[model samples]
Target: MDNLSQYIDWFRHSSSYINAHRKKVFVVLLTGETIAHENFSHIVHDITLLHSLGVKLVLVHGARPQINAALSGAGQELRYHKGLRITDTDSLQIIKQTIGAMAIDIEAQFSMGLANSPMHGADIKVSRGNFITARPLGIIEGVDYALTGVVRKVNAEAILQHLDKNSIVLVSNLGYSPTGEVFNLSAEDVATEVAMAMQAEKLILFVPQRGVMGKDGQLISTLSPVQADLLLKELAQDESVARNITLESLSAAVKASNKNVHRCHLISFADNGALIQELFTREGNGTLVSKDNFEWLRQATINDVGGILELIAPLEAAGILVHRSRELLEAEIDYFKVIEMEGMIIACAAIYPLDEESGEIACIAIHKNYQESGRGDHLMRALEKEARKQGLTKVIVLTTQTAHWFMERGFEPIAISDLPAKKQQMYNYQRKSKAFIKTLR
Candidate 1:
């Protein structure tokens, strides 16, 4: 019963994400390692589920390991220049054969309809063609890259047409040139470019590990492009670290983010349901590389009163927060700061002046969907900064249920009498909210 209730709660929470992602375009990169993993079928099943939910998917696949095996079987050694394969005529032939076979296998997986399977009755149609145009990498530093190429253009119109028809578009790491030659390409690069050209809502890359890790080995859930670049620079400086797949995917994510792709996610192919979790859950199972301004924090206006009230109504009903009328909020709206994502206020806090030396931080609330993701901490910090800017030396918060949270942020317990005289006179002893104060240096 408990598990069933939890499932119901989770489903209810996921409704918002479902509506947000409906009819959105997503470009997913599947490396050779990802495709070869045992969980590949599960990933395909998830993709089918997304398709059924009206998500337009463009799948870009790589075949480096397969190409290497084929080259070894043909008694040819793999050659590379600066992490890019140096594809000669013979190598290109082998790569084309390997990538084509893999594409066929992927299409077959999408065609699965066994009873009791996730893909059963999915009826997914996949489209693939000369959707990518390429130009050779050319010679660099006295070495010729031969048939190795980079994406010159993506046929966005053709891909959109397929997407409009509700077919999943499949693209291989092979690009066709105007000269009638197919050049070997990087799957990550292809995915990034396709996302940029199509203006996709998301670019999801499947890596071997559980997203980007910090020095403490914990997954870093979010990063701005600048932060990602700094991390990449730090990784590059370490001589013990060889160029790996994760770094490549991160680089691609950063590139996509810079090119106007709003969200680029790096998720693990080894973890079952990672894709779905990353997409639907608030605390995602991956690292997100996005623009810094994706979420805006600013002073709330009269237009934000409705959102603010909606955000705090549940807390007010539960007696975790004191209720305020819309008229009262509109008149004091200038004192509030809100964190807005997609024009919706997800978190908000207000600083009311109690005296010249101190202020009261009140009405702190974060939408349940955004809780536990650090928005509360962010709002608190912003409020503290605002308090300091107002020449205040101390900030006080009264909480019935979040006393520990305030203490964690350097607030110390204080008596109601310790609050400013004006605030103390107006305090309601009936609610019995605990008072805490922080001295701002």
Candidate 2:
């Protein structure tokens, strides 16, 4: 019964994403390495699930590893110039053959309808064609990238038509020129260009790593494009690190975001259900790149009451926060500050001014998942800034719990008598909450 309840709660939360994602176009880039991973079948199943859920998918796949194997099998040297495959005549043929085989395998996966599996009853139709036009990269630094090319145009109308007919559009890392020649292209380039031309809602890139890790070795959940660019520069300057899949995906996501894709994601291909978790959940398991802020502190609006209530309800039930009634919250909504992430409030606090020089911070709470990230301190800082704006010199907190948290933030313990007259009169002796105060500099 408890497991069932958890499922219901998760479904309730995911409904918002379902509603928002329906009929939206998402371009997903899969590298040769990702497609060959042990979890690839599960990833394909998840893709099928997304297609069934009304997400218009444009899957772009690469074949570098396959191409290298094919080249080695034929006794041809695998070559690269500046991190890009130098596609000579032999390499070009190998690239085409490798990409063709990958496309077939992906399409076959999408066509699966086995019973007793996630793909059961899924009648997904996949469409593939000459949807990309290319131009050669030309000679650079005396190195001619013979058959390697870059995207010049995307057949957005054709792809949209297939999407309108509810078909999953599959694009390979190969493009054609008007001169009737095929050119080797990067899958990331294809995906990013298609997404930009189609104005796709998201560009998702699968990588081996979970996501971009900060210097502290923690996954940075969200990054602005500007921030991503800086990280890319830093990575470029660091010689100890070899060029890897993560950097490639980050470059693609940054490119897509700069082209106004708005939202780009980098998720682990090895992690089962990562695609669903990244797309449907608030505070996703992977890294999100966006033009707009994914999480922000803002003054609360009437519409935020429900999210704030949901955030603090657990604390109230645990007797850590004072329970707030909806009616009272509605009346004092303007006094609340909330940290909202992807439309859900994760932390919140409200201030009730006791006198012109002082205010009492009330209902301070941070969701359990966010507490270890120092969001509580962030909320307090925001509230302190707000209090200063309101000409309050002192901020007070009454707590049965979290007194230590307040103390660590420079708050000093105080007697109940030190509180304002009205606050002292209304203090609950039965609750036995302690008082702590901080004076503004």
Best by lDDT: 1
lDDT of 2: 0.87
TM-score of each: 0.67, 0.66
RMSD, one per candidate, in order: 16.9, 17.2
Model 1 ranges off by over 4 Å: 238-243, 292-441
Q: Write the per-residue lDDT of candidate 2 for residues 1-441, one digit (tens) a residue.
A: 999999999999998999999999999988898898999999999998888889999999998788888899999998889988888886787777778888998889888898999999999989999999999988999999989999999999999999999999999989999999999998888988999898899999998778887777788888977688788887775444223677878888887776668699999999999999999888798999996765789999999999988888888898888788999899999999998876678789898888989999998877774564556778888899999999999999999978898899999999999888989999999999999999999
Clashing pairs in 2: none
Clashing pairs in 1: none
Tens-digit lDDT string for candidate 1 (353-399) = 88899999999998875566567888888999999999999999999
Model 2 C-alpha RMSD vs. true structure (Å) is: 17.2
Clash count list over all predictions: 0, 0
Q: How close is candidate 2 to the true structure, as a TM-score?
A: 0.66
Best by TM-score: 1
